[model samples]
Target: MRMPTRILLGCDFSSAPTKRKNIVVAVGARQAEDAVRLSALHRFSSLDDWSAWLAAQSAWVGGFDLPFGLPRELVETLHWPGQWAALMAHYGQLERSEIRRQFSGFCASRPAGGKFAHRATDGPAGSSPSMKWVNPPVAWMLHAGVPRLLAIGAHFPAHQPIPERTPPRIALEAYPGLLARQLIGRTSYKSDEAGRQTIERRQAREQMLTALLEGRTELGLKLDIDTAQANALVEDGSGDALDAVLCLVQAAWALRHQDTPGPGYGLPPDIDPVEGWILCAKRP
Candidate 1:
């Protein structure tokens, strides 16, 4: 059994995951000289299955495409538990409908454009607000993700105020969009809409794969994938697969900095645990 020295996982999360809208994961292993191999791709039909896989991996450091925290302003306004631990516990007890209702009410009380309170990390990561319950529904992703990490006793770097520890497994918030923009600058490479999956998107994936393999991005790591795997990655125009790879790259980037001060995987100095920063996201 080859226990990987470093595991890079890119998670394309879905709050209401089904067979069609399954959680997409790209798993990679770090080799010598910061080279990574796309070892596997996984899909989860439900959250229980995903949680089990996470629990079984007792030795890995990875990145997940889910917000780790909610906005401080929203927490305060709703009078939910203020601290991270208490807040997560409180949140874990709520069903989806309640979450939608609470989040919708919060938006209703505010003016348009300012309906959702922003996390400091949202600007840099280009992520949907953690409080948003519709559209991308990132709020639900946080709801589904954070508690599982806590249950599995995984370490969350920059996910909270508690000092980061090098545990059996470590997890960090990741946003593939950040890495994609860095590579393809304003070029659209993926789409869920079948009609929107064009040759241009495939070409963009080709460029992205080339950049990753050549060590051109901020990850400072090279990817080792054969021609067949490369074809699979490029052909999946849903972008879920590529997004997972981007997140994996981000994980690799953060792991290199895990031993530094705060051991936060290159997370910024001013990160708020209640509104955590995305690993390697560029601040505006």
Candidate 2:
């Protein structure tokens, strides 16, 4: 029997609807060569618009760069109902500014250095708090991204809302760093911001691709790159090639558990199933 082609998606997410810092969705399919081949790249104006698109996923394996839940500590401290449904209900009642104020107050009450106590998995996963406003502000991404996934009844770890008559939607919380670190060992990649670009960084990217194709990383996924693709991943400053690779890792993970408990595509063992994963550097 022929295997069904897996539709794969990678997202560079932002919570707010703005001209800058908007969310980018990269769609592709896993080729017989075991590489993720591009289909389309979309930029959405708002979470609602993005959700509308996600509602169409019947054959997709998605990797989103957003945290799925608030820290248990944060949720409990705020006294805003612990269950996912109740918490979302309460959160939905408040405005964005109000939510920011509450979180800011919580930080103010804590010691300077210990202001934010994150989950054990957060550091390794390279994710920002769903509430953090600065430096990879992922809180907004969750607010913007999760609800859409929920509305579409996408299968995620913490928020499992079932959409009636919808096709099976498989979405994963992905961390791009998981695969990047495996190949590059915590080095920087192409930055969209112009101020951070450098020649040495460009060289590092090439070395990273070579290492990935040579299977030198700890990840079990082997890269199949020809001369042109390798150059695209390494020399092109867009980072599109690497992002697609991240989607491939997510696809591999999803395929492994497509028929098992929680559909085998749930968060990793170390991750709190409630908190979910932001699928970064994954091993196939």
Candidate 3:
């Protein structure tokens, strides 16, 4: 029998226990005539707990909604260590408020045009503004998530502080919204806030789910869910099931390019921990 491909998706992450609420969905893969069969989801509460689960799995792909790197100019201006490890260390030493203050001060000192030093490709990708505190805080996510990925031995690009001895693991930066947008352009499928959920929004989410399964979206990929099952996942309100399905789609996308010569995934050599990769899977 062919071994199953395990896939994980992490959402709403934080560095401390008070901010411990997040969702992790583990997916298992199977082969079918028309599409890939993905198993049910496994949820987790903490990154450390998720790390323990990751150690036990074999081949897998993950979609993490976290930034992989900080802007190099910010690092240079702040006089923090240039290397990834040293930068992470400096970040770890400061409290959240201290870090925010330092970043805000850095922004204040720069000229208006260069107020937020960005990665080279940020403009093309329509990613979050580098200096924004919320709605995709790339800097904070890098500070919070990358160290854990490295500690687990995942292989990311040079800009991350990964240990030399970590496993042959491949880390990809993923944004669930990328796929969600393709399904339903700028529609809100879910919200953690109670007041934001509405019947029309739920119907739109269901349509998005239908589009994913029918391969009607521009993702250039197909999902294996039937209508009934897809509706159930969308109606769950938490978006965990839909998120897991999205991870499965990401895993599928990775599998097609897993055999590329270098990093195995199409990850850039200087993958900013502030950006995400769609990891490639290697054949066993």
Most accurate candidate by TM-score: 1
Candidate order by TM-score, decreasing, is: 1, 2, 3
TM-score of each: 0.92, 0.79, 0.77
Whole-model Cα lDDT per candidate?
0.82, 0.64, 0.60
Please identify model 1 stretches exceeding 4 Å from their true place.
1-6, 161-165
Ranking by lDDT: 1, 2, 3
- Among all windows of 10 consecutive residues in model 1, the one with the lowest summed lDDT is 157-166
lDDT of 3 by residue, 120-205 (tens): 44554445654456665666666667677767766654345444433345566555666777778787788666677688778877
Error of 3 at 237 (Å): 2.7
Per-residue alpha-carbon lDDT of candidate 2 for residues 1-284, written as tens digits (9 for 90 to 100): 44345577877666775655456676766545344455566777777777777776656678777777777788889887777766765766677788889889889999988777475467766655666856766666666677777667676643554334324567777776667766777778787666665777788788877675565754344555467656656664656446656655566555545544432554454445445555532322
